[model samples]
Target: MSITTYGLQHIKKETQHLSQEQLSELLLRLARYKKENKELLAYLLFEAHDEAAFIEKVKGEAGFMFSQLSALSYHAAKGMRKILRLLSKYTKFAGSKEVEIELLLSFCVNYLEYADRRTTYKPIRLILTRQVEKVRGLIGKLHEDLQFDYLESYNNLLDDAEKKLIWFKKNDYQL
Candidate 1:
């Protein structure tokens, strides 16, 4: 026999019938089962009210991670991928395109500053390229004025990458 599952609307309707104490208990129980769920709940409770502060805090953590990246090419690539995972999680929690773009831009800028530019590590290079493309796509979804502002920073990032990394081609990333 197979168990039944409900859609979000059904779940919401059911949840609405529960008392406040029961709802809180349910949420706490759910959070106790998964680390990500707990983090998301914590963000919603504390950091969601002050998005700017949250973004700055995340950026600072990313910066510290970048600074501590391994010297070896392969290890550095792994470290970068880990950082990207962290950013991806926070972006999901924030659920804002602007926040996503800002975090990604911070990743790219930190990469250019601290990564080994001369290494022929394909994964490392691909990480930056993929992130640049992602940022460009996200920027397109914003308002025209915001797009223009982000484009300036994006263009500057590409220019800086072109100058610093031998493998980076500005033409490929051009708007």
Candidate 2:
């Protein structure tokens, strides 16, 4: 037997028929099943109203996570990955490229602050490089004005990373 899956339009139409109380109950039940669903719902209901505040909150959390990172390269890499996961989830909840770019930039800055760039750990280095590439890609998709602003910050970040980290090369991530 196969379960039926409806398109988003069909689901929206069906939901229009639901009474307010019924809709509320359905959303609550849906949120109960998965952690991601719950987080998305909470973001929509609360943080969606003030995106800047939400972004700042996520940045603060990332900073705190960075501060708690282990001095050992392997452990620090693991912790940095965890922070990336958190930023990825919150970016999904925001559903905006600009938010994604901002969160990613903030992550890179936090990583630079707490990370020991002198280490030969590939994973830790790759994490920063990957996020910089992601931010660079996303910046291109934005309006030209926005692109100019983010690109300045992106260049600054790359300059700092190159100066501080042995693994990062300015030529590798250039636009």
Candidate 3:
């Protein structure tokens, strides 16, 4: 026999009459059991109000992670992947196209600076390319004014990446 599970709608209806204290207790219980629940609860309670500050805080985290990356190519690739995953998670929590674009731009800029040459590490290049495409898609969904602003930033990153690629090729550091 299969057991039926309560959907979120059902759960919401069941808890609709919960007092503030009851709600708080429920949240604490959920948070205690799962890391994602804790993060979502923290976002709803704290970071949901001030989006700009939340974006800045996440950007700071990405920068800190970047600063601590291993110099070895394999380790650095792993660190960059972790930073991207964290930034993506925070972007989901923010639920804002602007936050997503800003976080991506921050990530791409740092990535271009650190991982300039695709020949050095293909995975890093793949990560950078994927993020740039994501940024492009996101920019199109924003309002026209914000679209222009983000497109300019995205173009600049691409320009810099191209220049670096050319320079690296001329220097012949790697094939």
Candidate 4:
């Protein structure tokens, strides 16, 4: 599946109709991990924040679910948790010291395919613009991985998401 397909309007409509319990159950399932399945937490958080109501319902629960997983430091899940926290504030999201969205997504993608790709969530496949790789390079260009650079990385991600708004429009996102 190429990463450029935007089922944006359709996805928006579909997610809006989902009941809170239905959404919660999906997220709960996403949050689960087996004895050694490490990629589970990150992928679950990716799908939980499509709408504000959904975000309002699951952010805390997602937080709690990940807090336990955080202890395991499943390579990328902690980053996923922070990414979701930001996405949950959509519309209200003003941007911050952001990790590039592309990098964050790439991190998740790498984790997904680490063991198997077919079992991972599908939207990730849609984010195929190599945005993560470009962002990784940008960070490398700065050569500034510091104690506070982590905080600034989130802002960079926010800037990237806002840029996507303009990008999607130019690509003829009428729906």
User: What is the TM-score of each predicted model, taking all chains together?
Assistant: 0.96, 0.95, 0.86, 0.23
- Once model 3 is optimally superposed onto the true structure by TM-score, how far is the C-alpha of residue 157 displaced, in angstroms? 1.4
Position 112, candidate 4: lDDT: 32
Pick the winner on lDDT between candidates 1 and 4. 1
Task: Name the lDDT value of residue 22 in candidate 3.
Answer: 98
Write model 4 residue lDDT over 1-175, tens digit each, in one string.
Answer: 6676668898788779999999878766654745222233433355334433444434444344434433233333444545444443431331222323333443433333331223233333334223344444445555355423643553444354445433322122110
Poorest lDDT segment (10 consecutive residues) of candidate 1: 166-175
Candidate 2 deviant stretches above 4 angstroms: none
Task: Give per-residue CA lDDT, model 3, range 31-96, as digits (tens).
Answer: 999898899889989989988888889988898888888877888889999998898799888888
Q: How many clashes show up in model 1?
A: 0
Where does model 4 exceed 4 Å of error? 1-94, 99-116, 119-131, 137-175
Where does candidate 2 have its weakest 10-residue lDDT segment?
Answer: 117-126
Model 2's number of clashes is 0
Overall lDDT per candidate, in order of appearance: 0.95, 0.92, 0.80, 0.41
* Candidate 2 TM-score, true structure as reference: 0.95
Deviation in Å, model 4, residue 123 alpha carbon: 6.9
lDDT sort, best first: 1, 2, 3, 4
Best by lDDT: 1
